[model samples]
Target: MTIKIAQISCGTEYSGIQSEIENAAATVGGKMVYPDVSYEEITRAVDDFGFDPVSPQLKLMIARAKALADGHYDADAVFIASCFRCAEGALVRNEVRRYLQEHARLPVVTYSFTERLKAAQLLTRMEALVTIVAKKELLARERQVGLTAGIDSGSSTTKAMILRDNEIIGKSWTPTGEVIGSAQEVLDEALEEAGVKFNDLEGIGVTGYGRFLIGRKLDANLIQEELTTNSKGAVWLADRQRGEATIIDIGGMDNKAITVRDGIPDNFTMGGICAGASGRFLEMVSKRLRVEITELGALADKGDWSKVNMNSYCSVFGIQDLVTSLAAGHTIEDVAAAACHSVAEQVYEQQLQEIDVRRPIIQVGGTSLISGLVTAVGEMVGSEPIVPENSQYIGAAGGALLSSGFLEGQ
Candidate 1:
């Protein structure tokens, strides 16, 4: 039972806990190999692996890969450490889990230390992670069953996901026009891609702004709260550890600040649908600036935001501010960056004022795809936000998880 751990950390702020880990490792009959890895080594690996260098947070991930690959820290398991509120820590931890599982063929565990946690709780989580890793062989084997479908019908788009034995087999989405038509279309597309029929689905779940339409039209077996669906989907996809996380879901016309505790909604706040903080606001500004929404993030990144400002109260005024800033000799990039800041401000000041946003913040929805907005939100929150892959389709993913659970129960 003496487990040897090759440990990597995101920072030295929690170095005080090193002794605690040592004590706990000894108690559990394990030893840790925490080599003092350099940033230069991490940067080299990042370049070698072709990871995006612009984001400083990626250093954590690159460093992890480098540590695992290097022959110095040879061990039976890997231990990753980061603060609970550290966005880089959360993202890197999740990525490393997959990497170690596939490439290294080793068990990995992450310890998310928080100042708010009592010593007992912190030790408990660490012990639990170690136990989970130790029991990977037993937990890895899961029962496979029939296919399940989850459909998300939002105000601006519809998405569908097909899950077979808890693995995603197919996913598809389309712009929303008529609710039922869009829902049916995406569902059909996903099913076709998965080579399955509607009748073959053991259970179906639906969620989103227009989820009511789908529930009424399709008679979905499960109709969940949009916030619940968002949190469930985001938590599932991110593979976050136990405890709570903040979710910023920016949809077409609405935005939600959801607090998910143990993969369930603890609390939430919804921003006004007509506010300038939503994706529609971004689209409006992008159109006025004669730039594609996809290009807005890059443009904003290039701009000097030191002198830029924009109205955050209303979309109309926000667009007007963007136009005025451009006419006053400010570059379009500057205006675009300011627009991104304005959206973040609107969410932070107007919507998130009521909710206690705990990190690691998982940002989802189409607007979150904008790199600039993500950066702005991170700056405003004083913490980096974790943007997962295929975030916009999290609602559909959440529904799929719910439907899959339902099928398993049957």
Candidate 2:
């Protein structure tokens, strides 16, 4: 069944990414539908929203959102978008998203697009919305009941995990190269460690950048986007699955901040404004400090970030700041702490502002293993983040947990 996704947007046609948006939805077994609203309805919606925007396009956007909220449209999910350049559009997009969440009670995602926006960029968001609609029960499941294996084929690393009756028995993490081969290697390692044959697995799930390709190759039972999966895994790992919590995943190529309720993501924002806010920047900083990435965390814990100035928002400039700091006689530990702090601050400015952050903030992903980065995030959020056991395997664990929901039918 193709999930009907409502497209409530301001300028996709003018920006020349409307087709890209449609194609993304189609690729993920979703059909984009425009909610119909008359001009009178648009006027009424603007009046009811109590903030009339100067742009007529934003007025129409509000009308469509109102129509959805009032049950005048039938949609499984909602996708609200506007051009990045439009401040008014951004305001309307965020308001519409909240409106739908409150009144429509539907799964929703909002994006600020550019003319260069490609379907690849929107695929995960569209896929996640569809997953929330089609696999609601699967995502809501709290525990893994049977033998299941999960593979996370990430941009920089691949990980695999095996779960049996709510316990993770084995897991593997390796640097990613050839996507399929990386996934297979970790799967083999995990299965070997678990002392289980591949055929013994009741269900297999895959996620991350290479999910579609690897899922098709492996015939995965649950091929899902990481937003929902990561939230589920984070909550489950942190033992916060029963309450409202915020999840932060600072990944290799990008970052994700999700607001989840009862283990399911109700709101999420992914992608960074630049690479400087991601794990890749931290990796470069580690190299500049003549330390391994894993060792950078310990080094950062030993120094004060205020001792150096490394506030560049671009990774290249960030590195330049690092070199300048070291040349000025700053210690490597201080430089490392500054780099971590810079990344955390950028994440807060670019992504965290997109949602209402709930507490018992859980930080997951490979970066979470870096105590320095975790500390910086804690400092930025004014709360110490809960880093669960085996946090690095969150994507794989999420896959395994969600896939187990398919076992009953199989």
Top of the candidates by TM-score: 2
Instruction: Give each prediction's root-mean-square deviation over alpha carbons.
Output: 14.2, 1.4
* Model 2: CA > 4 A from native: none
Reference-based TM-score of each model? 0.64, 0.96
For 1-410, candidate 1 gives per-residue lDDT tens digits of 66676666555345456666666666555677764557787677677655544446456556666667665456666666666566656666556554554466444545566544333333322343343345343222233246878888887788998888767888899989888889999999999999988888887888876776787787787676566667777877777636779899888877878766666553455655356888888888889988899999888878866667787578888877777777789998888888888888888975565456788999988787899999989999999899988888888877777655545445
What TM-score does candidate 2 get on C-alpha atoms? 0.96
Q: By summed lDDT, which 10 consecutive residues of candidate 1 come out lowest?
A: 135-144
lDDT of 1: 0.71
Error of 2 at 320 (Å): 0.6
In terms of lDDT, the best-performing candidate is 2
**Model 2: pairs clashing at backbone N, Cα or C within 3 Å:** none
What's model 1's lDDT at 270? Answer: 61
Local accuracy by lDDT, each model: 0.71, 0.90
lDDT value, residue 38 of candidate 1 = 78
